[model samples]
Target: SDVIEFPSSIGKVTFTHKAHQELLKDCQKCHASPAGGTIAGFDKDWAHKTCKGCHVEMKKGPVSCKECHKK
Candidate 1:
């Protein structure tokens, strides 16, 4: 239920964990852990690959950079 902020070369991406929890039924949908962890290892390439992949597969969520990233 915390705001997970990930700082990147472009900007900081603030992800609302609580909002996702309401939409998704499983924790592993985005998170690799039940307790969650730092986004230090989650880079742009990783996000584009993982996030966009899921979005394309499920036909939901945003795949655009500006949609998730702050200008």
Candidate 2:
């Protein structure tokens, strides 16, 4: 196995197979190729766009810290 560092405007967000799989309800929901114009770019923003997007929109979960802050 290998570990890699991914730097962003905020900080590094590690990605793992287990962590990713646990979040998706279906493949086509967020991983479609050539993704639509509204789709998020990087992993961090993608997570916020998908996960936190629903949470905040529905007002059911904690307001994500990263959603408003840069770091």
Candidate 3:
């Protein structure tokens, strides 16, 4: 139940690893590498894009800033 936090101007973004794992069974969903391996070392922009993209497509989860960032 490790929570990864990212610094932001609005607020820190706390990502719940357990929750994401529960929702996405495969790690590749977000950790997919260009070489088709593992470990992409994605940055904040990539995370924001991927997360918001999936959330937008699934029509579930939070896409808004305030929803994820602490206000």
In lDDT terms, which candidate is top? 3
Clashing pairs in 2: none
Looking at model 3, the pairs that clash are none
Best by TM-score: 3
In order, what lDDT does every prediction score?
A: 0.75, 0.52, 0.77
Which ten residues in a row are the worst by lDDT in model 1? 34-43
What are the per-residue Cα lDDT tens digits for candidate 2 across 1-71?
12234557675544343443455545455556533233446466676787567667767643556543333
Evaluated against the true structure, the overall lDDT of model 3 is 0.77
Q: Can you rank all candidates by lDDT, best first?
A: 3, 1, 2
By TM-score, rank the candidates, best first. 3, 1, 2
Q: Could you tell which candidate, 1 or 2, scores higher by lDDT? A: 1
Backbone clashes in model 1, listed as residue pairs: none
Candidate 1 displacement at residue 57 in angstroms: 2.3
Model 3 clash count equals 0
Q: Give the TM-score of candidate 2.
A: 0.38
Expressed as tens digits, the lDDT of each residue in 1-71 for candidate 1 is 46778787787788777777777767776668766655446777877887778778889887777778795
Stretches of candidate 2 off by over 4 Å are: 1-6, 33-47, 55-63, 66-71
Return the TM-score for each candidate structure: 0.67, 0.38, 0.78
Instruction: Specify the poorest-scoring 10-residue window by lDDT in model 3.
Output: 32-41
